[model samples]
Target chain A: MDPLILASEECDIAREVVCVPANVLDLFEFNSVPIFIGLGAVIIALVMYFALRKPKLVPGKFQASVESLISLVSDSIARDVIGPEGVKYVPYLLSLFFFIWVGNLMELVPGINFPFTSRMAIPLTLALLTWVIFVVEGIRKQGLHFFLDLIWPPGVPVALKPLVGLIEFVSTLIVRPFSLTVRLFANLVAGHVMLALLLGSAGFFLLGVLGGDISVLRGSIGAAWFVVGVAIFMFEVLVGFLQAYIFTLLSAVYIESSLHPQH
Target chain B: MIADVLILAEEATESSGIDLLIPTVPELVGGVLAFAVVFFVMWKFAWPQMQQLLDNRQKAIAGQIQEAEAIKAEAQSLLDDYRQQVAGAKSEANQIVEAARSQADTVKADLIAKAQTEAQGIVGKAREDASSEKARAMTEARQEVANLSIDLAEKVVGNSLDRAAQKSLVDNYLASLEGA
Candidate 1:
């Protein structure tokens, strides 16, 4: 038996699943990503189904509430960023935001504590979809010369064109989607890791199984940490909702910028 | 710390592992089947009815708005007609009052002029009758005066006057009478 493995085993097993390697951050893995994506898809279908199964003059309470929420998300995030012209994309953005949010929330279930969004693959895939939409939509709307708008930016001087063009194209092509994916993935990973550490450390502190001298002050601090962890977990629920919103909001803003440019 | 917990959970899962993974290839197949079924059901049941309901609701709203506008127009026209009728009635009453006043004035003047003419005609007839009566009285007096003087002269001349003188006077007298 390896001492390193033994030392590693001292930590909670759930923490290993939630944490990722430093080296593999750049690589894309598909294993758990599609599974969570599929889960999100199922949740979307059920929500749509349950909300729309029956027909009524006035909507049922649940359906009406869901409809209002959907429309609110549409009006707030989609309409505010993309304007009324982008109302057609409401269904896609609404489903995407909710699906990602539910994926984050699924890890909070008692027996089902694996944070799927903590994996890089899910956010990366969604970011890819968003980037594809923006690029395709920009070109489709403004023709192939839309790329020129990114480079020239319409109002800048000819002397600075080359430097600005290089910077703009690189940032537009790379940094935009990269930031979106990494922001969501990093937030999920950090939030999950923080929650696991706090919760798992409290267990060790209360039980005193770390083989060091246990004291009344350490145990009390552990209780305090445990309570604080609970409070943070509650706050993290809010963060889950916010991060999903930010991602969707950023994507919408990006699409808006891409489609029209600054010209 | 959670890693150790996860190991325990993993060991437990492995002892009675049921393969929770939903698989990859089957997803493409199941996704198609599921989406197709959902689309078909939506097309068959939900869409047609929802569209019909939306159309009917739009029509109902439009009809209500049109009917309201029409009623408003009708009410406005009715108000205008009533106002015009009231104006006409007022005008007609004024004309009738004016015509009656003029007829009363004309009739009053005609009555006044006719009364004056009647009074004048009566006065003229009375004046004519009085003048004719005065002429008749004057003629009767003159005939009586002439008869009385002649009687007196015959009485005086009958005894006083003898043959030739008396006869001369009487002859003068009788000659005068024949001449007159």
Candidate 2:
């Protein structure tokens, strides 16, 4: 038995591990990521089902508020950035925004103190979907010429064409999706990890104080850290909404560029 | 024993934690399918109703504006008609006044002419009557004088002269007097 193992076990970073649920059958092991995604889907479906089941020309407060959320994405993200042709993509963009938002907000729920987006898989998949959409749209609208034009922007000097093309390809094809995936994943993961650490340490301190082992100074520090954790929790709420907005906005910009690459 | 258990736990975590950053095939498939279902439901149900409501509102507003404009034009035309009718009535009243004044002037002139003609007729009739009366009076006086002179001559000659002789003497005397 290594003393290093003993020391490592005491560290708070161990809490960051993915939680795998027990296998219901011999076939598959259910996990938190899939469960939360499913939960988000159900919530979205229910909201749409009730709010839009019997729509009115004059909307009530609940229906109006829901419609306003939808139109915010439609008008600001899709129409403003992507223009009139963007009307076609409003539903898809709205779903993405709301799904991500709900997934991110799971961390705030009491027992479910984990955001699904804190995992890399969901963000990566969503970013890939965006990547596929923009690339396909570009190809469909511009033909094979889409790749050519994307790789070789018009403003560059003739001597630096290949260099610029390489940079452009790397950035557009690889870096864009990678950055999108990492930005959402990292922000949520960092918040998730920080909260776990602060709360975990606070719990330890509280236990020590209850057991009459911790000094008054350490107890007070633990209380202060707990307070800080609460404050971060609130801040993370804001971040969750912001990241969802930013991801949708970037997706709209990418789609716009695909549609009208001349700009 | 605790150290041994902690080492085993650390090793297990290190091995299994790799899956966190890497996506499982099942989860990926589930996410994509789930999102696809959501997108379909929203696109089919919600969007069309919202667009319809907005369009209905816009159409209602446009209709109201057109109706207001029509009413305004109708009111304007009616006002113009009333104004024209009033102008016509005013001119008619003025014409009636003018006609009545001219009729009064004509009536006054006729009365004056009629009165002057009647006065001249009365003056001429009075003068004719006076001249006729004077002629009658003068004839009557001459007859009286002749009768009185003949009676005086008869008295002076007493009773015995013949009737035919007296008459002839008188006539001869009278004729002599005329010749002298």
Candidate 3:
């Protein structure tokens, strides 16, 4: 059945499409998001394992590539953003980056066409993880004073302290995770939707043309849609990488903020 | 576009509230569990190994640099030692040459003095011999002349006087010749 045509015919069918299983076992059995999450983890594990299997003083191509990636996260993301103490968090940061990147790439994969991070739940989970770490790091590093620092940033004018304090409290505690989750989830969802629409429209129109429908216009539009879809597909690849970078970079920034609060 | 997507999504889910933003329990749990496992494995195995390898590489490079510096210093020391030895040898050679030249000069002066003394000795001996030979020749000539005079007198005077007298006359004439 043509899902787009069916969706149009009975827009009510959208409910059935969206009504996912709620039970824990049933959700796992039915949901591809968790399954893909597990798959992404496996891929990361295998790649890391194989990359580090035969460690050499002089690295080969695969090892060099893997080491360069590790250096990117460790040096560029963790150390550069979060400072020297960030070395301790390199593993978690590295895992987060690869996991999200692989999850984002799933939108382009054939058998699995849905990006796992398009679901709010997964991004929420990851963002919450980051939120927990940064908040815990803040508490650990600054003790109880972290909250005071968060609520009342130094150097604010006495007249505006209360206003600034309120804003800081919301921004630091509430908005950070929300923004992280929505940023990753919304971007992937939007990219996924655009791709699906363009490709689905292309399929529909091209099938009409191939089936000898009596419109030269449909064929041209289908060709155009396909071309644009391909372009968007390439763009999503970049976006996948960019979103993962942004997410991890933000996490680092948050961690740094926690570690070194303003005086 | 976002509004349209949201509307479509809302229609699909048939929920109009923030329920769309909410995650199912299973996915959140699964994602967390998966990431946790990955983080654990990475922390346990991969990153520490990589860190070790990186540290070892840095140490190896540092060791090599130190070794190279040591070798360079040793080479420089050896070169300096050789230069010092060469300088000593050159000075020693000059001294030896100077001593040889001085010794040669001394030997030349001694030889010249000895040759002069030998020449003087030969000249003195030659003078002594010439004087002796002259005396002998004069004596022989005088004796011969005396004998001839005696014979001539015997022939003329026919043994007029004694031979002893003639000998005495010859001796007296020779003595007179010596006195003149």
**Judged by lDDT, which candidate is best?**
3
Q: For residues B1-180, could you state the per-residue lDDT of candidate 3 as single tens digits? A: 335545655554553335556788888888888898889878998899899989989998999999999999999999999999999999999999999999999999999999999999999999999999999998898888888898898899886568778888998988997899
lDDT per residue for candidate 3 within A18-83, as digits (tens), equals 211121112112355688889988988998889887788889999999899889999999999988
Clashing pairs in 3: none
Residue B174 in candidate 2, Cα distance off native in Å: 48
- Model 1, span A1-263: residue lDDT tens: 32222333354433232222221221122344445556655666676667766645466787776666665566787788898766656655765577568767855756444456666555666787789989999898888788899777888899999999999888988888889988887787667656655655565566653555466665654676588679878988988888888888888887887767686
TM-score of each: 0.55, 0.65, 0.76
The number of clashing residue pairs in model 3 is: 0
| lDDT score of residue B145 within candidate 1 | 50
What DockQ, on C-alphas, does every prediction get?
0.02, 0.21, 0.27
**Range of the 10 consecutive residues with the lowest summed lDDT in candidate 3 chain B:** B11-20
Stretches > 4 Å off in candidate 1: A1-36, A55-57, A207-217, B1-180
Docking level for model 1 = incorrect
On residues B1-180, what C-alpha lDDT tens digit does candidate 2 reach at each position?
224433544465465655556778767877887777777766886677667666876787888899999999999999999999999999999999999999999999999999999988898888888888887875565445445556676678665456566556666665586589
DockQ of prediction 3: 0.27
Which CAPRI level is candidate 3? acceptable
Q: Which ranges in model 3 have alpha carbons more than 4 Å from their true place?
A: A1-31, A107-114, A141-145, A155-166, A194-234, B1-22, B110-124, B158-168
Two-way TM-score contest, 2 vs 3, winner: 3
